[model samples]
Target: MSGFNTSGVLSVAPARMLVPILLILMWYLGRLHSQYEPIVTSKVSSRLEEARKMIPSVKLDWPIPLAKDPRAAFNSSKLALLIEARPLPHLPPLILHMMAVIPPDWRFLFIGSNESIIGVSRAYSIKHQQVIGKLDLVELPPPWSIASKEDVFRLLTDSRFYDEFLTDVEWILKYEHDSILCANSETSVDDGLGWDWTGAARMGDGHFSGYGGLSLRRVSVIKRVLSFQARFNDSEPEDEWFGKRLWVLPGAKVASRFDDAIAVEDVYMERPMGYHIREGGGSLDKSVWGDAARRKEIFEYCPELSMIMDMKLERQRCPDDDGNGDREMADVQVTTAVLGEGDDAKALPNDAESAVLPPQPPPLPQPWKVSVTTFGSPLRTGID
Candidate 1:
């Protein structure tokens, strides 16, 4: 019995060895998959962190390669005003009054209903033929039979609109038809940036709040938003469409109250730059805001424009008569060559809206020729 037991004891050695061997194999396979995780994971984490610092908006899934700011194409062409024109008899005055405060050189795009009564006007210095103030009007069909809510999208996603009008335009200042700039609103605050680098925390829903009806938008932000149009139902409220798309847009942002995008809700701040003259409450009734003192409170916000309205009222702004004369001038066609993105040129249809001027550029031609940097990594200029 002792002899039999000694032989069997040797068999136990293989079983003991098998247990340790299996453990070693399992550990080896796991390490094969994750051996580089610490190093790779750290690299990925740092890149993601950098992207966050660069774009503090919604977090991106992956790091964006550093490149020339698409915004740089805007160059000096920043801060375009997109005024929504309600079909009111006073709209021309309102547009003129708002344009008075705006610098003559800055871009202004007025969007109105298809049957809108907006007139074409140009302001020029009498001393020189050079045009001073100008406004471009674009009219589109209402998304709803009567509602103006969805009109912004027609401009937002329509390639022809961008090609013909907004290619060089950046920083859209959207004012609902009834909203008007108040007296104390600061025009200097709009440096055309839609981001806050200072990290001052906002109290409310940030830009997801539809720029609160009077907000400035970065051109680059909206172009990115255009790609997501299909995901949304156009029939829905335009603000809801923008909110859902903008919420998910990785690097898109609009300036906030601190930047003077607006601060109507700020109890700490006494006044907002503008007020919406809604039908029920804040209607654009002349009796309420007709006085020089009252209107001055609304227009006096900008020193440069202190007497601009007075100047406009004193004398009419008449651009030089067309060579074809006033009557024929009605049919006088103006065209501009589409620049920058080639897609824009091709996207423009044969219709008059997108056509370049018949033979010459308009009275004041802003030829927007932007050169994109594609080959090399650009120097890291701080996102201004």
Candidate 2:
């Protein structure tokens, strides 16, 4: 001891340095692994669980009448189907046929303008099935007649409306169960050709066109997107607004099963779908089958649609849009703008391959001086 073992001290010094270095390397590796981990992580799962817990204990399998009469046997187990529409009467018979094909368990929740068209849709919905309950219609306020753009912004951004929208969202989320499924009247159906609707980019020099249809799972995702929209309240175009918001949410997936080759054209940049439909003065009737001739034309020109349909049916899986990856807002904006708009207003290609059309200007409001009947509430009547 008195000799002060310097050799031992020197040996111990290297061990002390090596221990800290090894600890640092281990810490760095742990961080790296976490950074590159898959998005469906424990954190995301926990968030979903928390969100679910926050919702009320509402029963999804509410009993509903099966046949046309409510007095008839309430045999169905499913509760509701949410369909977004504008002028509902114009909905195609094909859409009605598809709805009829659904198992007799679900009821329809039609969101659209409170017009006679809704009444027609309601009649159609209950024609084959029972009218368990009157359709719940959530009317969107018109954006055009506001005093100023700031007023429009205020309406969208107001926390009160945001809270209301959130309540509507939570109500829908509570109903999200295996028994409930959503279907839209409008989708890009393949015409039994060989055109791949799920392609990522367009092929020609003209405007790029793509499909905008989604699966049942996407309905819940859309609710989450609306919640985010309420939270952020950015005033972009509707579909673009919806797409951008979806891109930013954690683990949100998009349905991109449209022909990719035609959608990459530069002309599609300025226009986008939902923009024109919402802005352009047209009824849902005109929107649905308005371009039937065009669809036939495309099938004649590109007979590959029939082949594509067969492939799509065989695959028969929901599109892993956005590549099942965490998509960025920029990606959403870029993709939506490119895919939504076509070459020109009417020039926008319409076929059995693509459901989305380019943005159009909003309709001009009816003159305020005109005499009008005030049904229910003035605020609600004017907005529609």
Give candidate 1 misplaced runs (Cα > 4 Å).
1-76, 82-86, 113-115, 118-133, 139-148, 157-160, 186-189, 192-209, 229-231, 255-268, 280-384
What TM-score does model 1 achieve against the real structure? 0.42
In the range 228-305, model 1's lDDT, one tens digit per residue, is: 555343666544555667656676553433443352322122345554434423333344344455556544553323
TM-scores, in order shown? 0.42, 0.30
lDDT of candidate 2 over 165-219, digit per residue (tens): 4333211211101111113212222211132111122223112132222112233
lDDT of model 1 at position 278: 43
**Which candidate comes out best when scored by lDDT?**
1
RMSD of each: 27.8, 33.9
